[model samples]
Target: MERIVVVGAGQAAGWAVSTLRQEGFTGEIHVVSDENQIFYERPPLSKQVLSKEATYDSLNLFSPEQIDAFSIHLHKPDRATQIDRVSQQVTLESGKVLAYDKLLIATGSRARVPANTWKDIPNVVTLRDVQDCERLAKRLDTAQSVAIVGGGWIGLEIAATARKQGKTVDVFEYAERLCAR
Candidate 1:
């Protein structure tokens, strides 16, 4: 059977797997994710999840039962270290290797906070994942004022959420306007 391996367990990766099945590719399917959580909605991380409007349990794109029913093998909390193009094998951090007839790389982008920024501070945080939002929400409870470094979508979204929580937010942008491209 044709074996398909997808590296990264984000929304795109989940969608690709579903699409492959919908397209009638009845081969072995494997999904690898560095995160322990299953594929969940990312947009909510900055909005509902960050604001405590939704919990991690409710943000899941697919439940464990559904994954099992669909026969989609999940390798959570595992990172892909390297890819052997010639041998068609993917090496993981746990010393496990998966060979694939078709491979998909659906790794999502991370929050691009500069290394020199105030990221090292205790209360300062970024809204990227569920854990990040949960931590930031907890910090917002104690933070009187929040200084957001970026003026991008995520920064602005978090700023709005923080503002709703009654915290004063200051957005720091190197460029003239917000989200300057």
Candidate 2:
């Protein structure tokens, strides 16, 4: 049996696995992700999740049952540390090595952390994972105004959500206009 290893269990990886199954590539599918949660969407994190309009559970792209039905080995709380192309193997942070006939690297972008100068400031927080959303949501309840740093889609989403919550919002964009990216 052919073995296929997928690094990263985000939306892209989820879609890829479904497409492969649809295309009749019935090989072993092993998905490795850093997060413990199942395949989930990120777009809602900035808006619905933070605004308390939607729960984080609603973001799941694939349920545990669907993943199990597909015979996908989901490895969580682990990151791919190295890929030995010559050996056709991937080494994970947990010291687990997987051999694969085909590999897909769908590792998405990491949340950019603020500069060290902003570290000491308690008001400066980043929105990325579920915990961040929970923390920010609580903070928004007590905040009167907010200054968002980016003008991109995520930043815009956050600003809009904050405004909906009745908080004064000021967006700071390095670009001349909004939605630069």
Candidate 3:
């Protein structure tokens, strides 16, 4: 009757849960995520989703029914602020602590904003999760030009989307070549 706690509902967390279930681990599975949305793929955030060719519904890792069938507990829109090794529990921002026999941390990274001045701009955004994607998509609807600070996978994908939408694109990369880092 062990309880497995997974922090971050990214691909790794989803994989961990599915693997446990596939292996016939009849234990309690709990997932904690800061995002309000459920487990979904991240790659599309830059490509199809940004271009309006695909939606989050199409990128869902598992449906609500599927999650329910697995009997997995989802605690979302809340972050795990601390992990107590001695107590074997995860403390969430909601002040709820979940005791666990095993734990997994798969929280993904966030986009870094090199220029602080861009934050003040209404249209300037960092593409990260679903929310950011949606905001950028909306902003792009009436945008005539787009300035991408980086030339990484996400940045390039966004630039492609912008070009497809007939918007002018300017990419700024610190590296000599695109996606060098």
- Please provide TM-scores, in order, for all candidate models, with all chains considered together: 0.90, 0.89, 0.93
| CA-lDDT, candidates in order | 0.84, 0.88, 0.90
For candidate 2, lDDT tens digit of each residue in 55-172?
Answer: 9889998777777777888788899999999999999999999999999999888766457778568888888677778778888999999999888999999999999989999999
Better of 2 and 3 by lDDT: 3
lDDT of 3 by residue, 1-181 (tens): 9999999998778778888888999999999999988678999989998887898889889888877777888898899999999999999999999999999998988778877887888878998899999899998999999999999999999999999999999999999899998
Weakest ten-residue segment in model 1 by summed lDDT: 110-119
After the best TM-score superposition of candidate 2, give how far the Cα of residue 24 lies from its true spot, in angstroms.
Answer: 1.7
Cα RMSD for candidates in order: 1.8, 2.0, 1.5
How badly does each model clash, as a count of residue pairs? 0, 0, 0
Better of 1 and 3 by lDDT: 3
Give the C-alpha miss distance for residue 66 in model 1, angstroms: 3.2
Off by over 4 Å in 3: 115-121
Model 3, position 129, has a per-residue lDDT of 92
Spell out the clash pairs found in candidate 3: none
Candidate that scores best on lDDT: 3
Worst 10 residues of 2 by lDDT: 111-120
Write the residue-wise lDDT of candidate 1 on 1-181 in tens digits.
8999999887888778778877888899989998888677788888778887888888788777766666788887899999999999999999999999989998888777678566787766767676787788888889889898888778888899889999998999999999886
Global fold similarity of model 1 (TM-score): 0.90
Name the regions of candidate 2 deviating beyond 4 angstroms.
113-122
